[model samples]
Target chain A: MGPLIPNGIITGDWNFVIAILVGIAFGFILEASGFSSSRNIAGVFYGYNFVVLRVFFTAVIVAMVGLLYFDYFGWINLSQIFILPTFWPAMLLGGVIMGFGFLMGGFCPGTSFTAISIGKIDGLVFTVGLYLGIFIFSESFPLFKGFYNSGNLGHVTLTDVTGINAAWFAFAFVIIALAAFWVTMLIEKKVRKKITEYKF
Target chain B: MNTQTKNNYKPNYINPYLGGVLLGLLVLLTVYITGRGLGASGAVKSTVVTTADAISPTLAKANAYMGKFISGDRSPMYNWLVFESLGIFFGGLLSGIIFRRIRKPWVEHSPKITSKTRLIFALLGGIFFGAGSQFGRGCTSGAALSGSATFALGGVIVMLTIFGTGYAVAWFFRKLWI
Candidate 1:
């Protein structure tokens, strides 16, 4: 009854329109959460602002719980959901590189797009850099082609690896997220008190 | 492009927790409706593949990575992510307008560094991100956020590594932000 597209309730042609609408909602939420500002985003690391952590963790846990509940009610078939394939080595290298990107650029791809929409020059430059970087990667694909395709473990979830029920995992995440929220709240207070130079 | 000395002041954003709830529900809705979660970097990948193909059909087809994405029957740019990304731009614009956050073009960075330095880092960071996403197969929206939400092992791996690396290096780059 769920995943309307795969179930044939919503046709393929509607995917594009749905894509645009979903994207709009995604962009609006990100921007409205102060993600458009690099300073605000960078604050997650600096401890002055934990909005990034708060928003991200909360969103993940909520959705995680929602998925579990949906499956419990038999509203959505868990088997039909897409799971990202685990390519360990490639993802590790990629994650490390992206970490540097986040530190230097202060915006990820999605956030930068929002920043660009609001007339931020930094966002525009970062986006152009994205283009140039991808172009270079495309031209030199042979060098790292092996690395990219290596370590393929297929689409596996945490439950599969840990032998934990999906519901219990969702519950555990909620607890951890809540604990982090408290600790970060305290940290943000202390950090903001110390830092008067940077305005959020 | 709408650069002017506009929007000198804008209101604060919604509460983080509230924003998270809305975002979470949206993610749930998206997956329930489309059978897939949100993505950001995939759109950029499409752009790269489509652009390379358009520029050099022969060369694009010869490349190892880009070659797979190329097909003579259709343009790679016609993918869902591209259209979705276009909508993201429009959605962002709409929010900016409502919040009066749209303003003259400016570089956001720490006062410790010059704007030129900030812009350079931004570009370099973006370059790394582009390469990384191709390697990682997704970015924050696609993997860390959406993937983690579904309990995917890859999602957890990405979310941990990306943030762990962020924490690992945040001290070194303190000048860039703090």
Candidate 2:
């Protein structure tokens, strides 16, 4: 009944068209939310702005709950949905490296695209660096191929690993998001009072 | 700290909560339609493959990683993520036009640092993020956000580790942002 393309309700021919439309929406939402600005994004860590936290946590919880509801209504078959496979060591190392990237670059891959759209030279440079880095990785694949493919725990979900109902996990996430929103608001206010150079 | 600047100019972005809701719904709709989540880095990967393939088919095909993506039937750039990324650029451009943020290319950074310094850091950061995404199997959108929404264990693990590490190392790089 759902996941239209996967179930044959919609053919593959329309896949590319749909991809464009979805990506447009994704990009528009990101830019409109002030994510196009590196300063705005970095504010989450510095406490001057919590927009990243607010938007990210809200989106996560909303999608989490929405997926559960869709499953409940039998609108979408949960089994048909893609789940990212786990490779613990590799993922951990990747996350650590990306954290440094976020701190130094102040933009993730998606956000950098938006920044570039608005004529940010830094975004443009960052993208070139992305290309160079990927090229390096591809060339060096032989060196780490063994480790890259290691620690495969195929497509397991939190519910499967923790033995908790998905609904409970969703509820917990909502609570955490709400609390973070409140706390960050306070933190932003406090931090804003002390910072003079940046105005948002 | 300057009341004059604060009064004269106000940021015109949408509400964070509203933006979040829209983005989340979009994620749901994407999965409902395509059986996959949103991605950005995949497109870059595709482009890299295509470029390598063009430069030296032999070397590109010889590489363990790039070789897997090369197919005789179509260009690697013909993939879904590539089209989606094109849309992302256009969509971002549309938003920039609407918001009147489009401008001559310039570096954005803290007043304390020179633009040259910022660009250098940006490049280094991009390199790190690009390499990390390959190992992580996805970036924030593909792995962290979209993965967690589906309650995927890998998604949650990557999300936690990413933000956790950011928090841990953020202090050292405070000068870069603040």
Candidate 3:
């Protein structure tokens, strides 16, 4: 009933059209949330702003819970959904590198695209960096090929690995999100009092 | 020069919670429709593969990484993520136009740093991020968000590692933002 493409509810030719529409929605929402500004994005760490945390956590929980409901209702088959494979070592290394990139660049790939659209020079530079990085990786594929393919645990879920049900995980996330939101608010008040400029 | 207007200006961002809900729904819909999550970096990877393939078919085929993506009958540019990224670009443009946020070119950074410095770092960051995404199997959107929503263990690891690293490095790069 769901996953319209694989089940033939929607044909392959419409894929691009759907992609464009979905992407537009994604971009609009992201930009509208002030994600176009690196300063705004970086505020999460500085305690000046927590929009990134608020939005990201809420989105994840909502989606997580929603998936559970959808599965319960039999609207979407959970088995058909794609799960990103767990390549532990590669992901850890990649995540660490990406973290540095985020700190220095202040924009992730999607956010950078939105920033670029809004005429951000930094965003454009970041995109060029992305191209160059990929180009380098492609050229030197053999060098890190073994490392990339190592530590493959397949597509395993937290519930599968931890023996906990999905619902409990979702509930725990909601609680953690609520706690973070409150703590961030307190931190923001303290931080804002000390700073004379850079109004959030 | 409309000083009053400038001084009184307040940004028009939607509520974080509401935006989150919408984003969540969109992610849910994406999974429901395609049985996969949204992504940004994969599109760039496809372009790299397609471009290299176009330049040297033999070399592209010979390379272990590029070879996996190359299909003898078709082009890599025809992949789903590439089209989706194209959509994202247009979508962002549309939103920028609608909100009147599109403007002259400028670098966004802390007042402490010059535009040139910011741009250089941005490029370097993008390079690392792009390369990292290839190894990580997805970017923030594809791996972290989508993977986490599905309770995928790797998703949690990527998410924690990224934010953890961000917290660790945030102090050193404070001048760039704070």
Candidate 4:
């Protein structure tokens, strides 16, 4: 019943307008949360600050639970929503590469944009690199076209994989996220105590 | 009350939990309204297609991948993600202004490294990110957050591998951050 745009309840013309509004909320939340700071973001790995882990896990759990509730309440049709298809090899490779990128650049695409908004030169350079890298991929598509398109697992959800209810997965995830938050906090305290130069 | 000044300025960052809740709700709203989640890398993908087309319509048209996005019917830039990405910039700008964080260009890096060194890695990092997003079919925003939220197995897989890999190799890049 919901998912207005997909269902035609909302006109196609409104897509762009909605995009801006949603994006604004996204950007505002990210910047206000201190994601614009590379040091803060990298802190997840260094154990100085665990804001990334805390915020990330919290958000995932909240959204996961919200979606399950929405489905149960008939507010939205879960089947109509888009799911990320499983492209096994490509995804694994991409995630590994992106992990390295996150470490070295100290920012992801979303965070970089926010940093650029505040006049960070490194952010600007990262943007330039994004273009160059993508352009290179596009130009060199022929070399890895087969490999890129090899994996073809269809769109699947955790319920399908585990043969359990979505609610169960949601429940389990909440527990896991909470535990992670707790442990990261301990690590953060210890790391910060040792590094006097680091200031949050 | 004490007057506000640059020297006495305070650093303000909201509680992580609060921020997460807001972000989570926003993600829920997006899926509810659009039947899709938010994305950042996809917007740049569009730019790449448009740029390739601009340089050589024939070449871009001939390339199997680039050609998939280039259409004679509509401009490549007229995309939902492109508009959304623009909003991200403006929204970030708004936040910066409110926080008094808007300032002249500067490089953020560890005290151990030079600005030039940081920039070089930033560029290289972006390049890897760009390639990875394409291969992964989404960036952190699209794949990791929105994907995981949606309960997609692939999203969860990507999220795990990404963070897992980061932790596995973070020790090697200690100087870059720590």
Candidate 5:
């Protein structure tokens, strides 16, 4: 009944078109939620604001739970979904690099695009840098190919590797999200009080 | 207060939780429609491949990673992520227009750092993020959000590492934000 493209229900050329429409909604929501602002995005780490955390964690949990429901109700074939393959060492290293980048740049690729649309010079520079980085990686591919392919774990899931049920993981995520929301609210209040000029 | 330089615009940001719910639903809809989820970095990757293929097809094909994207029937520009990312750009523009948030180019930085310093870090950050996305197989939205929604183990790892590392290095980059 769903996942129309993969199931032969929504055949042919419309798949990519629909992908664009969905991506538009995704981007619109991100921008409207203050994701267009690098300062707001960076606020999650600084305690002045937690919009990024609130939106990100909530969205993840909701999608996780929704996927479970879809599978349970037979609304979609969960098995047909594409899962990102895991390379443990690469992920760990990549994540660290990205983390450093995020703190320094205040915007990720997606958010930077939104920021650029609204005329942020920093966002534009960040994107140019992204291009350069990709170029460098391509030219130096032979040097790091070994580490990139290390710890290949196939396309495993949390349930697959942890032996825990998806429902349980979702439940744990919900609890953690709620707690973070509570704590961040307190932190934001404290941090905002100390600042003099910035207004959200 | 310098009234001339300041852009007096009312910031009407949507409620964060409601926005999150909408984003989550979008993710769910994407899965239901395409048997996958949302992504951002893949679009940039496509651009990189397209540019490389044009400069030197032989060199592009020689690199194993670039070859997969180059050997495709049409140009890499015709890829799904590329089309979707275009929509993302337009969607963001539409939202900015509707919200009246459009402004002249400016850097958002702390009082401590000069605009030049902020821009420099931003470029450096982008470099690290681009390279890292390749290694991790995705960025925050691609690897962390979409991958996590599907319960992928790599998604969890990427998510943990990104935020974990952010907190670890946030102190060093404190002047950039706080």
Candidate 6:
């Protein structure tokens, strides 16, 4: 009844149209949320602003709970949805590298696009770097191709790994997210007080 | 009056919780419709493949990584993520216009550092994120956010490691943001 494309409810021709609509919504929400500002994003780490954390965690929990409900109602086939395959070492290396990128650049790929839309020169430069980096990666593919494809644990989820029901995991994540929100609110107050040089 | 003006200077953005809900619902709708989640870096990869393929057909095909995306029938740029990414740019533009955030292009950096220094770091960071996305098979949007929302183990791993590493290294780069 759902996953309209896969189920033949929506044809292939509409795929790109849907993609565009979805992306528009994604970008619009991000910009309106203040994600276009690099400083706002970096504030998460500095404890000056917790907007990133709040938005991110709330989104995660909402999606998680929403998915569970969709599955329960049989509106969407959970099995039909794509789950990112686990590649342990590759993902670990990638995440570590991206962390530094986030701290330094203060914009992820999605966020960077929004920055560029708002006429950010830094965003433009960073995007150029993205092209170069990808080029370098492609040319150097032979060097790490083996490592890239090595740790393939295909399409497993947290429930699959820990044998806990997905509901419990969602519940735990909600609790954790709520707790983090409270803690970060306190931290933001303290941090903002100490730092008057930068305008919030 | 000074404090009031300072408060007024704050960015006029939606509440985080509301933004989160909307974004989350969007994710849900995307999955419900497409049987897949959202992505950002995939479009960049496609562009790279298309450009490399155009520049040197033989060389692009000969390469181990770029070769996989090359096809005889259609351009690599004719991909879903690529089209979606175009939408993201336009959407951002719309929001910027509505919010009046569009301005003459300038570098945004902390007062402690020069714009030159900020741009350099931004490029370096972009390089790392670009390379890492290839290794990670996605960036924050495609991997961490969309991945975790779907409960994928890889998503969880990537999410934890990314934030964990950011916290671990935040102190060293304090001047950049703080």
Off by over 4 Å in 6: B1-8
Candidate 2 residue A158 C-alpha distance from true site, Å: 0.9
lDDT of 2 by residue, A1-200 (tens): 78889999999999999989988998899999998888999898889999999888999999999998899999999999999999988999988888888898898889899999999999888888788878999999999999998998888898888899999999999999999999999998999999987878
lDDT of 1 by residue, B47-99 (tens): 88887788888888888888888888888888888888887888888899988
Second chain only: TM-score per model? 0.93, 0.94, 0.93, 0.94, 0.93, 0.94
Interface DockQ of candidate 2: 0.80
lDDT of 4 at A199: 60
The CA lDDT of each predicted structure is 0.88, 0.90, 0.87, 0.88, 0.88, 0.90
Q: Write the per-residue lDDT of candidate 5 for residues B50-159, one digit (tens) a residue.
A: 88899988889898778877765788888778878887887888899999878888887777779999999999999999988888899999999999988999999999
Number of backbone clashes in candidate 6: 0
- Cα RMSD of all models vs. native, in order, equals 2.6, 2.4, 1.5, 1.5, 2.0, 2.1
- Residues B45-113 of candidate 2 have per-residue lDDT tens digits of 999999999999999999999999999999999998888888888888999999877889889889899
Residue B30 of model 6 has an lDDT of 93
Report how far residue B151 has shifted in candidate 5, in Å: 0.7
List the candidate 2 regions with Cα displacement exceeding 4 Å: B1-9
Tens-digit per-residue lDDT, A121-188, candidate 6: 88888887788788999999999999999989999999998999999989999999999999999999
- Residue A46 of candidate 1: its Cα lDDT? 83
Ten residues in sequence with the least summed lDDT for candidate 5 chain A: A191-200
Q: Which ten residues in a row have the lowest lDDT in candidate 2 chain B?
A: B2-11
CAPRI verdict on model 2? medium
Chain A TM per candidate, in order of listing: 0.97, 0.98, 0.97, 0.97, 0.97, 0.97
Residue lDDT tens for model 3, A130-194: 88888888888789889998999999999888999999999999999999989998998999888
In angstroms, the error of model 3 at B91 is 1.8
- How far does residue A57 in candidate 1 sit from its true spot (Å)? 0.5
Docking class of 4: medium
Off by over 4 Å in 5: B1-10
